[model samples]
Target: MAINQKSFDQVTGALSSLDRNPQAVRQRVVALEKVLERAFTVPGTQYKVGLDAIVGLVPVVGDWVTGAMSAYLIWEARNLGMSKWQLARMSGNAVFDTAVGMVPFAGDLFDFVFKSNSRNLRIIKAHLDKHHPSTVIIEGEKL
Candidate 1:
């Protein structure tokens, strides 16, 4: 069934409001990081894998797709007023990941270990904790 224009507008409006909320943004970034870096566990092993590793198994296109996803974290950071140095560092992480990830077997292996999205998530969390304390979600507790 097709959604009516009014319903679509309402949904979009609600989403736009959430986009402006730091807490919502934090939650989104955290979820994306998990999906990108820690979504699956290997059988008979403690090791975890995520889309970044699985998708990077493809050739060059995979790296580029994941790299763009990584960029979203940095974009959100900029929206939150992160320092230039911080953004540059995050960008470097993404660029390095994409560049190295262009290699064949080595790049696939690197994708499994070098989680740039996780690193970027850490940076974003630190900034949020310091600047947007209200967005902080303590372990085992809902904010």
Candidate 2:
């Protein structure tokens, strides 16, 4: 039991450390953006779709859920000490997505193309690259 407890504690400690690490935050935000905006490719089409498009098929609740997820990215940005203007821009993107996403069918179509999370991810990446250069990820290179 003590061994098991020790392992669990180690895992939780690592996760908590990740919470404070800018690189971990960048990785998390990038993964979330991929999940929200480009999870899978559409059959017979080059276009990709993610939860933002799929879950957005539902009426009100889906938009709320995805909007909350988008807000998480903004929260992480704030934790990274991002400027107010950047935070406001990210918030505006999320709000616009949520607002337009409330519409019935048109909103579903909009979600497939708009990709607000991707936009916000770009913003976060820019900030991280400029301020926390060590967090910048090089594609195809192991860290």
Q: Which ten contiguous residues of candidate 2 have the minimum total lDDT? A: 134-143
The local lDDT score (0 to 100) that residue 98 gets in candidate 2 is 91
The C-alpha stretches of model 1 lying farther than 4 A from their native spots are 1-18
TM-score of each: 0.86, 0.86
Would you list the C-alpha lDDT of every candidate in the order shown?
Answer: 0.91, 0.91
Which residues of candidate 2, in runs, are more than 4 Å off?
Answer: 1-18
Candidate 2 structure quality by residue, lDDT tens digits, 1-143: 25788899999798566565888898899899999999999999989999999999989999999999999999999989999999999999999999999999989999998999999999999998999888766884534
lDDT of 2: 0.91
Per-residue alpha-carbon lDDT of candidate 1 for residues 24-96, written as tens digits (9 for 90 to 100): 8898899999999999998899888888999998899998899989998898898889999999999999999
Residue-pair clashes, model 1: 0
